[model samples]
Structures are given as structure tokens and as C-alpha cells.
Target: MAALDMLEREPDLAFSLNGLARALKVTPMALYTYFGSRDDLLQALTERLLSGFVTVVDGDMPAIRRVEAWCFAARRFFLGYPQLLGLLTWEGGNTSVAWFDRSVVLIEALQELGFKDAELSRAIIWIWTSVMGAISEEIRNRTAPHSLSPAQVESLDPRLHKPVRDMLMLAEQPDHFDSFFAYHVERLLDALRAIAKRP
Candidate 1:
């Protein structure tokens, strides 16, 4: 948790165990005492943030509602943490199984809602990818300067270009992020619902 706090203050914490330890005024190896390895620490950091943000679902609640509540909390959490977004992208550089269990929790919640094996797998990947992608897009579009220039954004002008430009512009507006994220969330839930429907 301290490392996460330090990460917000120091972007280098995403990659540096030494930086995090130094911020906590401890030796680098001391961090491994709490976490088995640097990768473990990163997983723990991610888990800690999500746990703080996502409340546990009540089993008696409608499964669809449970999934919706879980994802909305997840999107809200990721949106608030810029440093976590960087670390999420950094995670692709390594193979860590530690975070998979957290993902399983999401998948299993859907399973209780009656999603079968293949659909559960698809749903898990779909939910994670869409939520992370949307938030990452919003963050990059907002904080980082746009890679596309105004001229570039305007250059595409056939039938579809206006819609593309409008979507790109919508991604940058802070006020619309919730609706943007919610639209995708609802769409994902719809897919899950179809997958769970009785034949």
C-alpha cells in the first residue's frame, strides 16, 4: 500500500522496486518480505487497490446486478488511478499468474449467475479487456497529448469519418467518461446475459 502511494508520487515506481523501497525508507529486499518477489508486489499492489474500491457482491442479489455492480466499481477504480494504468500496461512485459485469481473471482461471480465454462472464459476476457481498454483510452486521450493532430482528426471525411472523429473527441471529455464506460459495461453484460440464457 505504501508502495502504491509512493507510485502515485513517483512514476518510476511502476518499474523500480528500489524506488518504492526507498520511498518507504526501507531496503529493496525488505519489500520482498511482504511480497515474495517484485512481480508479487505488483500483483499485491493491484489487488489492494481493487479490494479498496470494489465491494463484495451479496450472493442473494440478482446475478446480473452483481456483475454490473462489480464492473462499475472496477471501472471507477481504474479511472481514479493513473499509476495503476501504467503498471497494467507494464504487466504485459512479464508473465505473472498472481493476478489471474483476482480475475477468476470476476469470472466465477458470473458463473454463479449461470454462465457455463466457455462463456465464462469469454466473458472474463471480454470484461477485463474492454474496461481496461476504455479507461486507458480515456486516460491517454486526456492526460497525454493526442497523437493525432486536429488536422489529422479532421482529415478523415467520408461517411464514417465524422462518427470516428466524434467518438475520439468524446473519449477526451472528462464529463462523458462514465457514460462512455457505462455503455461498454452494459454491452458486455448483455453479452454475458445471452451466454447464460437457457437453451
Candidate 2:
């Protein structure tokens, strides 16, 4: 946790294994026993993040609800550790299957709507890209005054106000986080449903 916290606070300096080891108060060589190199540590972190999503959703809810929960959990996770955003941008050699497994649940849900494998894959890509793009924007412009919460940032900057308001408009009536998520998920699911109804 300490090493991750350091990395979260200092993205550039924390890119190396030696730096992580020093941050964790362990000898650099000691880290080698657990993770072979910086890349290995990054792979482990990605897996850990994905595993956390599985733990949060736990397969207990309805498919749509699970996706919504996963999105909220994922957003929170990224907000806590924005440094990981860089890792997510690349197609790393050490990608984790666990991440794919979480995505499979959503794809299967789409399949139930009669989407074929290719269609399901495309839907997943589109939904993930939308979610990640929103998250990336949030992280990049996160410097609103301490007095401002995310909700308040819109009101503080006229330029920001329009886009944020637009997103809220895209959300269902009685807009709130739950409604916002449901709105986006419904739109994506509706697209799949439409495809399903086609030949």
C-alpha cells in the first residue's frame, strides 16, 4: 500500500522497481524475490486491480446492476490511483486474464440479448472506451479548488460547466450517480438489443 501510495503521488519517479523498493523501505533486491522487475510489478498491480473489481461485484447482483457497480468501483479505483492510467493506455505484454474475465460477464449479458461474439466484443470495447474516456477527463482536470467537490467543479468553471451539464443531461431524469450509470448502460444495452433483433 505504501509503495502504491508513493506511485500515486509521484508517477514519474515511481516507474522503476528500485524506486518502489526504496519507497516501501525494502532493499531493492528484496523486491526481486516477489517481482522480477518493474514490468512484473506493473503486471501484478493490473491483476490486483482487476481482482478487486471481481471482489466488489462478487456475481451477486443482476447483470446490469453488476456492470453499474463495476463501473462505480472502477471509477473510484482509478481516482485513488491515477498513475495506473498510464499503464492502462498500453497493450502490455503482461496483461492479466482476470481483467478479461470481468469483461466476459458483461459480454455474456450482451450475448443473452442475442449479440454474436463479434458484436459483443465491439460493444464491450465501446462501453469501456466511453467509461475510460470520462475517467481520464476527470483525472486530468481534477485541480478544482479544495472547496470544490466533483459536483461543484462544473459550477466553478463556465467552460467545464457546459460539458459536465451535457453529461448530466444524457443521464436519466432525476440525475444522480446511479441514474447516470444506468443511463449509459441502458444506451449500450439498447444498442445490443437492437442488433439482436436484426437478422
Candidate 3:
């Protein structure tokens, strides 16, 4: 918990046994009593962060709606702990099995809707990527707030790219991000629903 507190306080700080020990006001050797290595400590923290992330939706709900609920829930959960995103990205190949295990409910849900091996894998990847991509955009918007100026949008030729200009204008307002993310999620689920219906 102390490690997580340190991480939340300084999200960019790299994990190290020495650093964590210092933060906790204990000797580095004291950490070794609880963790075998820095990786072990980090993995424990990661598990704590993700332990309660379940994607199970009510069976009474439409299968596609279940999937949509999972996607949105994942986005909201990860957005709450943006630091976990960076840790996961940095760990990459070294990530723990717990990370992949979080998808079991999602995989089962897709299976119920007729997805099989390869298709199921692809669907899982698409759902996760879309959620993560949206979260990344949201984090950027919240932290950096980069948006095109009206003058910049107007500088583009309207005749050639009116829609592009309009999109640029819309991007200027971070308030619309949730609606934009929802629109894409719905479109993606529509495509998945069509595929599920196919024989």
C-alpha cells in the first residue's frame, strides 16, 4: 500500500526496492523479507490494482450489451489509475499472468456470442485496444489539454476539407470526449453484432 501511495504521488517514478524502502522509512533489506525482488513487488502492486476488475455482466442483458459494458467499465477503471497503464506498458513481455487473467470473463462472454479461437482473440484485442486508445486520449486531454485553435481550423480550405475542419473544431472541446468515445464503442459493437449473427 505504501508503494502504491508512492506511485500515485509520483506516477513517473520508476519502481525500485531502494526507493520503496526509502519511502516507507525502512531498510532495503526489509523489503526483501516481503518481496523476492523489485519485479515481485511491482507485480504484487499490479495485482492489487487489478484484482477486483471483473467484466461479468448480467445474463439477462443482450450479449452485445454485456461486451459494451465490459469495454466501458475497463476504460473507466484504467482511467482512474493512469499510472497502471504506464507500468503495464513498461512491463510489456514481463507482465504477470494476472494481467491476462483479467480478460477471462470477457473471453467467456464473447464465446457465448459465437466467437471462436482466432476470432475470439481478435475481438479481445480490438476491445482492449479501443478502450486503451480512448483512455490514452482522455488522459492526454486531462493532463495536457491540447486542442486546435479556431484560427487554425479556419486556415484550412473549407471546400477541400470541410469535414476535417469541423472535426478539428470539435476536438477543441474536451467535454465531448465521452460522447465521441461512446459513439465509436457503439459502432464497434454494431460490427461485432453483425459478425456474431453470421453463420
Candidate 4:
């Protein structure tokens, strides 16, 4: 994570084996001992990041609650290491198991709520995509603004924040936020339940 942070902060610096070795106060040969190559080091870093998610999930929690916590945990993890999002395209050897286990738990929870296997799979995919897509857009907007002018912000469409804004505003009042998430969860569960009931 430290090496990745340095790379993110100094994109101009060449991120090679020697460079990283120097940054870590180690000889290039020493790094090669632990990681066979530059790609191997990157793979190790990716695995470390993925494995951290497993530690974030509370095994003692109910499956539904665990799913909710996992979603939030994932969001927080991705937000912290936005640069690591690019690593998702590459296949990490043992690191992928954490994500698969989490996904299975989520699917199982939905299935317990009476969703058909196929429908539960689709719902899980849709929910995760929606949340991650929203976070990605927010990160991109905050980091790289196409138009810096004040007029651009003023002229921007308000409709973009309508859904989230409304939710936030309502959630400000006591107990509303809890009710809001519960409402959405129930709606999602009901939809899945309907699919399960379908002949």
C-alpha cells in the first residue's frame, strides 16, 4: 500500500522494480527474492488489498446484516485505494477468494429470502454495479473536473443528484436513514421473492 501510495502521488516517477526497491530501502536483488518480477510484486499488492476485505466482514453477524456491512466495507475500501481499482482487471491468484465468498454469502441471503438462483444472481450483480458505479463517478468528478469554471457548476443539471439528494435529505431526520435503507432492502427482497414465486 505504501508503494502504491507513492506511485499514485508521483505518477511521473517510473514505477519499476529498481525504483520500488529503492523506495522500500531494499536492494533490487532482495525484492526479486520475495517477488520474482515487477508483475509479481503488483500481484502481491493486489492480493493484499483483496484479503483486507475479508478481515472487514464480521462472521458473527446475520447473513443479511453481513451483506449490508460488506457492501459498505467494500465501498470504504475502494474509496481509500481508488488507484487499486485499475488492478481489478488483472486476475489475482488467491486474492479472488475473498470476493467470491462475499458474493456467495450475499447470493445465499437473497436465496433465503425466496429469490430464484438466477434472479438472485442478477439482483446481486445489479446492486453491486449500481453502488460501485455511483462511487466511481463521484471519485472521477472530484478528481478530474472537465470544466473548472464556476459557471460550469452553476449550469450543471440538478437532476443528477435528485435520487441521492432526496435520500440524504430525508435521512437527516432521526430514524429516517434506518427506515430508508430498510425500505430499499425490503423492496429488493420483495422483488426477489416475486421472482421465486414465479412458475
Candidate 5:
């Protein structure tokens, strides 16, 4: 749709039916014929983006690794298209059909290892929340206006909180860590494995 194309080119622009119609070279009222309202259009857009989300993980990989794989996939999808940030129905990745399908894959993987009910629910929340938290922070830090300078960003020490400094040191040197996203997701997966081992 014209609105989607507009967003692709300029993600920061606020979406409006009039703006969409203008992009398509049609009258604003004409948009009503295709979509009932802004919400309807947004829902459609969300689905369109989510359709590309990976739905399956490698069965040969360990369950914990499968969690990492799926979470990373979700992260890549949204962060790749940061413009959808505002149109998203949920704060993180929860508002779309892709979220549901990916959750099932992770949940079933946990179930295969004998987790279910409350234990299962908590695991699902923990895994996806970690994924969403990481991606959301990445979008803001990377795309948000008024970013700190290279000196400001790279010069870390007493100015930043301990954990914050440690976490971000690699951003200044992307090569410092093999991959930041993989690092955190693996950390979360380690914790998840520990949690799963609990009685």
C-alpha cells in the first residue's frame, strides 16, 4: 500500500490516511474504501511485516538454542524495519500473529523437555520479554535522534553505571564482541536452562 511504502522510505513520519492518500495520489476519503480507519490499516501493516517472521527453528539444535534462534529471528525482523515501531499494537513484539506462532515453537520445545503449565508460561514470558527488551532498546539506541557523540558514546567509565558501561563498551568497537545480539540472547538462554533444571 502507499502508506507502507511511505513508511519504508521515511519511518519517522507520522502515519495518516491523508498522508497515505497523498502518497498514492488519491483523495484522503478514498482510503476509507480500502481501510475503515487508522487502526485497520495499522493492523494490516503489522500482519504484512510479521508474515516474514521465521516460524520454525532447527530441530537438531538443543531446546535452549532453539529459543535463542527464534528470539533472534523476532529481533531481526522488527529491528530491520524500525519504522513500524509506532504502529505496533504492543510495546514489544507481542501484538502480531508472528508472535503467537513463534511463542508456540518455543513453548513446545520447552514442553518436550517436560515443562508445562506455570513453569512453561513463565519460561515463555521470560524468553520473549528478553528478546523484546533487547530489540526495543536497540531500536532506540541506534535510531533515536540526539544520539551521543563518538566521544560521548565511546568514552565510558565513571560517567555510566557499572553494568551499563560494561554492556556498551563493545558498541564503540563492534568487533570487540563477536555479536552483541547473540551474546545477550545466549546469556538469557543460559538462565533459561538453569530455570528449566529447577524442580
Candidate 6:
């Protein structure tokens, strides 16, 4: 859709039927023929954005590893389309059919490890939230200007917030985003592994 292409090219542009119609060289009423309302259009855009999300993983791998692979792939997908940040993080974000399609991959893997009902649901929520959080943070770090400089950190009172000062200093260095992402992914996998082994 031309509207989707416009969004991908300029993500920050506020989405409106009027704006989209103008971009497409059509009247707002023309869009109403396709989308019932703004909410309908938003859902369609989200579905289109996430339709390609579930890439094939090595099915022969352990179920836990397969799920882990899904998490990493999800990270890459978000990074590729940072515009999804606003859509997926807000209200009604997970209501679209594509969201369930992507989530079923993890659900099946967790089911293979004996998870069911609430436990399975909780695991899915945990993994999805973690991936979304990491991707959001990574995008902010890359696009937003650093708030504190090394010199600013040096000027802080020595008696206060040592860890904050230290963190600021470290923040000045190149971010090891992949390594940081892998660490959290491992931690989440560890928790899932424990859950799978429960009596």
C-alpha cells in the first residue's frame, strides 16, 4: 500500500486518514471504502508490518533454542522497521492476526517443553515483553542524542551516586548492543529451562 510505503519512509509522520488520503492522491472518503475507521487502518498497517516476522528457524534444534532463535529474529525485525515501535508498544498492539501468527511459534515451542495454560501464557508474555523492551531501548540508544557527556559525569559530586557516574562513563564507550541483547536472551532462556524441568 502507498500509505504503508509512506509510513516506512517517514515513520514519525502522524498517521491520519486525511494524511494518508492526501499522500495517495485520493479523498478521505476513498479510504473509508477500504478501512472502516482509523482503528481499522492501524490494525491493517500493523498486520502488514509484522506479516513477515516469523522466519524459519532450525526446527531440529532443542525447543528452548528454537524459541531463543525466534527472539533474536524478532529483534532483527524490530530494528529493521523501527516504525513498529509506536504501533506494537501501545494499546491494541497485540490484537492483530499477525501478532498471534508470530506468537504461535513461541507457543508451540513452549508447549513442546510441557508448558500449558497459565504457565505457557506467562512464558510467552515474559519473552515477548523482554524482546520488545530490548528493541525499544536499542532504538532509543541509537537514534536519541546522549544526554550526559563524559565531562558531565566527571563533574558530579564524588560522594553521591557512584554507580550512576560509573554507568555514565561506560555509556560513552561503544555500546555492545548485541552482547547485551544476548545476555538477556540467555537469562530468559535459563528461566524457561528451569520451568521446563519443574517437578
For model 4, what is the alpha-carbon lDDT of residue 195? Answer: 62
TM-score of each: 0.73, 0.61, 0.80, 0.53, 0.71, 0.81
The reply for model 5, stretches above 4 Å from the true place, is: 1-4, 12-21, 26-41, 90-94, 144-168, 176-178
Model 6 alpha-carbon miss at residue 29, Å? 3.9
**91-176 per-residue lDDT for model 2 (tens digits):** 44555555677676666656665666777678778778887776766565454311334668655667887677565455334444
Candidate 6 — which residues are off by over 4 angstroms?
A: 11-18, 89-94, 145-162, 169-175
Report clashes for each candidate as comma-separated counts. 0, 0, 0, 0, 0, 0
For 8-51, candidate 5 gives per-residue lDDT tens digits of 78776665657777898988777667788655655665777566
RMSD of each: 3.7, 6.6, 3.0, 6.6, 4.6, 2.9
Q: Model 2 Cα displacement at 5 (Å)?
A: 4.1
Tell me the RMSD of model 1 versus the true structure: 3.7
lDDT, model 4: 0.59
Weakest 10 consecutive residues of candidate 5 by summed lDDT:
85-94
- Top model by lDDT, which number? 6
Cα miss at 81, model 1 (Å)?
Answer: 2.7
Give the TM-score ranking, best first: 6, 3, 1, 5, 2, 4
Tens-place lDDT digits, model 1, residues 1-199: 6765775665433446677777789987888887777777777665665554654677687777777776776666665665565555344486334346445557667888786777767777778778778777867756674546667766766675777778768766767767877888888878777877767
User: What do the candidate models score in CA lDDT, each in turn?
Assistant: 0.68, 0.62, 0.75, 0.59, 0.67, 0.77
Q: 51-127 in candidate 3: lDDT tens per residue? A: 75667677688777887887787777766666666555334357755677787767777898999999999998888
Please tell me which predicted candidate would have the highest TM-score against the true structure: 6
Q: Please give, for residues 66-139, the per-residue lDDT of candidate 6 as tens digits.
A: 88888988998878777666665446544665676787768889999999999988888888888888888887
Q: Rate residue 148 of model 5 by lDDT.
A: 53
Error of 1 at 179 (Å): 0.8
Sort by lDDT, top down from the best: 6, 3, 1, 5, 2, 4
